[model samples]
Target: MADLEDEPQAATVAVGSLDDVAPPPRQPPSEPADPAAGSLERARELLAAHPIADGGSGLALALREAPLYDIEDGERLLETDIPRLRDGGVGAQFWSLHVRGELTGDRAVTATLDQLDLVRSLVADFAEGLRLAMSAGDMADARNCGRIAVLLGPVAGPALGDSLATLRAYHALGVRSVTISGTRWTQRTGLTPFGQEVIREMNRLGVLVDLSGCTLETMRSTLVAAKAPVVISHHPEPVPDDVLRQLRANRGVCMVACTGASIRETADRLDHVRETAGPQSVALTGAYDTGSPHAPGLADVSCFPRLIAELLDRDWPQPDIETLTWTNVSRMLRDAEFVSRAMQARRPASTARPTPLDA
Candidate 1:
């Protein structure tokens, strides 16, 4: 994940019900007509046809701090809302379940559960616009129904409390993705035997093993161990070109985090990722509501189309853009599901625990 070093401190505010929230804010004025209007319109048309299936979002983490933050109305206090999501042409989103690094053991598990509850409640509250998606098919169904598919994932591996049982429980509760390393575990030399077991269990359960903040050793270890395709939800700076090539061989996806300070820079980063890692391995994620600074014109969820327009202006082929926005991530999910079924048929879930020696 991009550094949240500049994350704005959450204000102390009272919680309120969705009904008490104000009506949706007025839409901002459209940009003045320009020579690029044709590209912008084409971009919108392309997105309308193949809306983005964003690989990661931190809305749940933001909402954890401000429970009353409503998305129905254009909640300026936060980065995401229904109207903005619709405006952004986001058809699916992976809501990251992240807790502070200091949290561990039962505390971490409980905090993660709270984040899950918050996300589930938000989905329930906004059922008309959001639908929980536990599978690739569900995501496609939600998109067809004109609802944003909400996929849940834990951004920190510690949230599992080093227990496969807890991990299974989370899967049962609808977590489709789990980061293999977090702040505490990222420094490890490589995956321990137990860590390898966790990877196996996650594969059997069809959960995406996210290697966002993992060390190179850990990432390589996971790539070797995982039967299902893994995902890097955010751009990890430490990852070199070789790792990307390895990722391509592993049939994984790098959901490039668009953390650039400007739309053009973001497009450049995407292009670079596509070139380094094969086009099939590239995907897009805004990291919205993660408390990270966003580039101008890409400051909120509504700005995805603007970025797409920039890509169009760069003469990127519509097919490539379609692959970036929807195809790659969706295929990764479907591949994971396919691998999971085969793995489950071969072996039952392993009963494994980490030992001090393993650590």
Candidate 2:
């Protein structure tokens, strides 16, 4: 299978959750106006009636106008994303956060942060239509309220300024999970070193470690090292060579079945990881396209849930299910707040200034 090294410039696979991405610069939402507001409903209807994808504005145009986000209209992203999948049920979200990794440096970080800030802002702006899901239970809560719960994750974790330390800080910024690499070898735990330290650090921090965007060597090394339940967010994990044991099925590491050209490798890897990780593993599918191995090119607002549904078709191992969908990812977010409290205790009152950003 082609690894991130082989396809550095290839379009990024789905991120599934925006739990660990730094913010990117903002590209205005194709339609910032809420459909529920004044003439918005009528305007939205007219726009949607046409070939709709990016909030009814067309995917190309939305992509041109917005950066980082796959869908065009921020307002309709949740509205359109949830209904496409069978596995997703009513509340499962494979939300992903990503940016063009080739575009690196402070500019990338700044732009990524912009995207993150925009997501948070958009949540409030589209409060009636969306909710950010931090835990498995939060999904149910949002569904009962008829709202889509947004998951914040990074398309690549190493993009956060090259240190696990930086990732810890991001957790404070409301990030819930992180993909260690995205379509390239990175400095810390990327294809270069296998990122074992990165994996261990993430497990300890409570951030869900994503194993997509890695090569067999990179994935193998990191997976072997990662102890907490993990999610291979979008790609299928190929079966390991006899040398490697597939403990994922027993360890309960979560695995998200993804849309890609190599579905079999993905599936095999999923089974291997589950066999290696066991019971705690989980799988998620991409609903953006017809059920096929071809990667889901880009996400549209209405088709989000299709991704969820596609994964549900398989007999999801029970242990993998809870860890993937709710438990492991949930711990990443909730625990950060607890850590923040402890950090505050160690510092002198004067060193830590009172501010809304403290948490």
Candidate 3:
């Protein structure tokens, strides 16, 4: 297998433009650590020095220099191909076990499962370099070992075969979370009614209910019905009519921002999300958010960096960066055993929601 740094390139990599989130002066096998740097500072340095970017994208993508990784041509996991990314920059990945089945059928589910199996294979294939992760603890351990932590989950649950049992099966397979309904409803969860059932069951099982692809009603339903904590895996979405379009959040559940880039509106949207989901419930996107070559760094995370820096440049509430970055998701993971008695203490005895979100 080709190592991350060994991939084919168009050129020897050049310094672009800070306006463009410029790339670094030269491409080296590994980078040296900045002697004096905070998290955000480190992010900017990565972009400013990155070989792929010419100028800085912006603050949004500037938080960290880790390269945004993508699944390769349906087979190989290319961690080494992107040396910068594999070097301990990326914290967590929602390795998309996405079933292409939105309106299609079982084929989509099968395809999604195949993607998951590929991930499992990649675990062994890249074991020395990477490992599968579900809880924050697993991610922490992986990071400690200098390995990439892959958080696995289905893009949507309906593709899991049929009922909640299939969902449970996937959970057993190490899927810490599951986006129940896709852009629209399907077999597993009805338009809205079944959505409620799915959320409730997911909550009880301690499985994270993902509301990234569901409709506003579905998002609302899951937020309102969840027994355990839930996450909006792909929200702050730029797509029209997305229920969690901007920064809408529900009380209790945490909202992690994810769209194309973490830009301006994202900050405003995230503020609103924090207001609704509670200061502890709202967070911005952490990885793969800067896939656009046009967006060079964190500031370009949607032009939201300045805003994020203005609002949360230092810190925000939640369980600290680790929790927002990996712990919260890890808490509900099926494979993690690091849950403190405190976490169990914080969990609600019932799934009843105290309030509905306005997103």
Candidate 4:
């Protein structure tokens, strides 16, 4: 995949005096709508009708960009936006704390912390509907309690600079996953000697390594180095067999992104990967969020059920579908927490940070 280049600017609309143009006669009927939308709607209906068969237990999850911070002007989460996710059958979401690559050193760290504060405030403001979930168990608990479990992830490793301790520190502060690079390469791109150290540290800390926007080389190197399962939080393109084989060998999952271009062919690619790599290797993510840099297509969080529906239409088995929607992601997260907890148990009390569960 190419480094995410500067997106071509949106086409500007020209404004002119309406009085200068004459009124048209009758308009022709609109063309037949694509079946995708209707199929997606049917999927939503299925989710609503069935309710995941476990009360949102093992229900859908979305790797959404940070909604609270990225909201358009005059938008509010509690009053207006979050309900859409609720309506979309989203049981959990990984809200990103994206620090741009340009913000190096303390600026990046400070910005990440500020976003953390923003996320915390969101949980507080929407207490009944949201909860801060730092582990897989916490996520399940939040779902069981009928609240959407909100988890923290930061896009790009620049927020950590050159500090391995900073990665651990973020884990202590409830960051469960992190993207190693963004549109640009991070300080440690996993292709360098120091980058390997970063990957190993992330594995040791049980922080899920995300290889979303990194270079192919970075993805390969990181896969080799990471002891824990990794995820491509937003895979905007298809991978060759070698990459799929490597991901399978490393027990990683790629959250197939749902942008305009990515969405159209996602199912076909997903099928090919499943056939080549196995069912455990793929999951779903909607990176073309309201704040997505990609051109608009999939509208919002609501597009998820539609995606599920699309797969269903193709006769994907329910079990395989669950693996695509939930099980793959759930397993990765649960394993990360298991490793973390085991490590914490072995560590001396002086070295271990106090976890919420222990409290």
Candidate 5:
């Protein structure tokens, strides 16, 4: 994989005036066909064959605020509900287990555990609609059974309290993904030596690395160091084109957030990422209940079909759409699991401790 120094900068676009352009001859106006009719149907058909595997969400945080909020009820709470998830064709969702950034040490770890418990409780309470998934196979099985798979992921590295043993403990508790940066701990230094160890441990445990808020430097370093594929979950800003290109070599996926002024804008962002990095490296995240405003048409999780229809109208290939909705994330998880099995067989769990430099 190319390092940050070697990656090319994004090309700039220049605008030109149309002062010298001439107008074409006018022709008779004709009635336009309703393009949405055919495209919407096609989008739904594609979704039935391959449902969405959302990269991340903040519904758990919302539940933390209103413990009484019941997802089983037909009423929508924030951006998700049982009915809306079904309407949206979401087969698998990674509910972010995020705590306040101010909380640290034992307090952070404990709060994260509480968030995990809350997610598990929600899945158990709504057993008919939700199923806890720990592996890629589990996600597929959930979809096959008509239940939404719930995968757990911490929003930042601080949730681990700087302990690899705690990392293992969380994995035992069914945490499948961890964001290695994006917190105050590593904001200044990027990925420290200790962060590298965390990535290796995550690889050994089959936990997915999420570079949601890392700097480009950190992302490039992690890409070169990681053994398995990584993910950038729920990034609102456009991922730099250079990073998208680097993903081609690392086999990582950049999940486009569903937060724009309109569904059309969201589709345009997806188009840009797909064009930059092949369709195999692009995916979607509803980014629901993260306290961010969702797009007008994509106000809730039920609006995913609208975006898909837009893509279909733009003539996106069926296979490429399928890869965006499901194949990429599923393949990434399976690859992580494959790497874990091999690493575990070759070596033991890392016992290295953080040094003063890592701080």
Candidate 6:
């Protein structure tokens, strides 16, 4: 994710009812005159026509994307975006809380809290269209209820303020994963010793480890520490062979972000990954952001079907596509959730608060 300005401290917070908080107004539906509507609609149509996984299997999931609302810019999801996602056949989104480099110490934690509040407010206001999901089952429930499952993901573990308990608090608060340092906005190259400890704690806590912008050493060390499958939500170009080998051993999924590249280039990368890591190890991700300019033939979430359609046009096997689109990530989430439950059971009574959404 690209760096952005830090969110200012909230003067007052409303954690009560949805009636007390108001989200940014939704953007109007896309019309034919709109710049990207025609292509988006075509992709949506193709997505609906193709049933993902067939035989009533679960829906496809994306690993990373920015939140729908931009508090700094007063921008919100366009009215067409939800339909675009549904049409694109996206069942769940790990809406990322990208911590800017400027935020540090207490400010970082405050910023994370603010983003969490913002997403919760949006979900509450748009309950008909969205659900706050903490686990794979919750995501499936949202899909069954005809809504998008929104999971919390914090990028840059510095937001946890150098505390393992703080990390557990984040887990209790429903954060499913954390990216350990190295975001686009930061000059921070490698994980600190404390950062490594956080990874070990995350494994014990059943929280997913995210290696999005980490250094090669960071990825290597974290992969070794993590007991559960970690996710490289967005891979940088020139992916390392050793990292691929580690991921193959860890059973991790490398989500290929669909931006700034052609379908063929993306396909070639996935093919290369398969050749190196074997099948069911690579997945597709839009890393979609309403704020950024659209990638050709892949603009918003709605462009997903177009990707699948193009892959099919290339004669990619349907089963492999199914693994890339759905199963691998789903299985990873389930594995993490199981570990989380076991950890929660072993936790002390002093930590006996209800999980987020339950609280």
Q: Pick the candidate with the highest lDDT.
A: 5
lDDT of 4 by residue, 17-127 (tens): 877666789889999987877777767765553322111110111112334342222233321245666666777777777755578778988878877776777678777
* Residue 244 Cα positional deviation in candidate 5, in Å, after optimal superposition: 1.1
Least accurate 10 contiguous residues by lDDT in model 6? 54-63
TM-score: which is higher, 5 or 6?
5
The lDDT ranking, best first, is: 5, 1, 4, 6, 3, 2
lDDT of 1 by residue, 188-289 (tens): 687877788888899999999999888888888888888888898885573578878888888898887767678888888788778888888888888998
Model 5 misplacement above 4 A:
1-33, 183-189
Best by TM-score: 5
What value does the lDDT take at residue 134 in candidate 4? 78
Q: Lowest lDDT 10-mer window, candidate 5?
A: 182-191
Q: Give the TM-score of candidate 6.
A: 0.72
Winner on TM-score between 1 and 6 is 1
Can you give the TM-score per candidate against the true fold?
0.88, 0.54, 0.58, 0.72, 0.89, 0.72
TM-score-based ranking: 5, 1, 4, 6, 3, 2
Please list the Cα RMSD from the true structure of every candidate, rounded to 1 decimal place: 20.2, 24.7, 18.1, 19.1, 18.0, 23.9
Whole-model lDDT per candidate = 0.85, 0.46, 0.47, 0.65, 0.87, 0.64
Compared with the true structure, model 2 gives a TM-score of 0.54
Error of 6 at 342 (Å): 4.4
Which candidate model has the greater TM-score, 2 or 6? Answer: 6
List the candidate 1 regions with Cα displacement exceeding 4 Å.
1-33, 183-187, 236-238
Alpha-carbon error at 41 in model 4, in Å?
A: 7.0
- After superposition, the stretches of candidate 3 with alpha carbons farther than 4 Å from their true spots are 1-82, 86-88, 101-103, 183-194, 236-268, 286-294, 298-323, 331-359
Off by over 4 Å in 2: 1-79, 82-88, 182-194, 236-280, 287-359
- Residue 137 of model 2 has an lDDT of 63
Residue 308 C-alpha lDDT in model 4: 78
